[model samples]
Target: MHHQEIMSESIETTLALVDAEIVCFKFVVCGTVFH
Candidate 1:
């Protein structure tokens, strides 16, 4: 049970990082296109 909790937390963290990166990338692309 403890191992499962750790695994889930790791997955969530990884997903969050990926999501942040994607949002940053989109913002950069939009900024470039607009300018």
Candidate 2:
């Protein structure tokens, strides 16, 4: 139904945000270690 579609889109957006946060975290860790 339409509600389910909206739910899935929100879930996907949340997952994308988490993925970006993880990548940023890793980058910061690596930079700190190298520096």
Candidate 3:
């Protein structure tokens, strides 16, 4: 049970990082296009 909890936490963290990266990428793309 403890191992599973750790695994779940890591997965959530990874997803958050990925989401942040995607948002950053989109922002950069939009900025470049608009400028």
Candidate 1 lDDT, 1-35, residue by residue in tens: 99999999999999999999999999999999999
lDDT score, candidate 1, position 13:
100
For model 3, give the 10-residue run with minimal summed lDDT. 1-10
Question: What is candidate 1's TM-score against the reference?
Answer: 0.89
| C-alpha RMSD by candidate, in order | 0.6, 0.4, 0.4
lDDT of 2 by residue, 1-35 (tens): 99999999999999999999999999999999999
Clashes of each: 0, 0, 0
Estimate the TM-score of every prediction: 0.89, 0.93, 0.95
Give the CA lDDT, 0 to 100, for residue 30 in model 1. Answer: 100
Per-residue lDDT of candidate 3, residues 1-35 (tens digit): 99999999999999999999999999999999999
Worst 10 residues of 2 by lDDT: 1-10
lDDT of each structure? 1.00, 1.00, 1.00
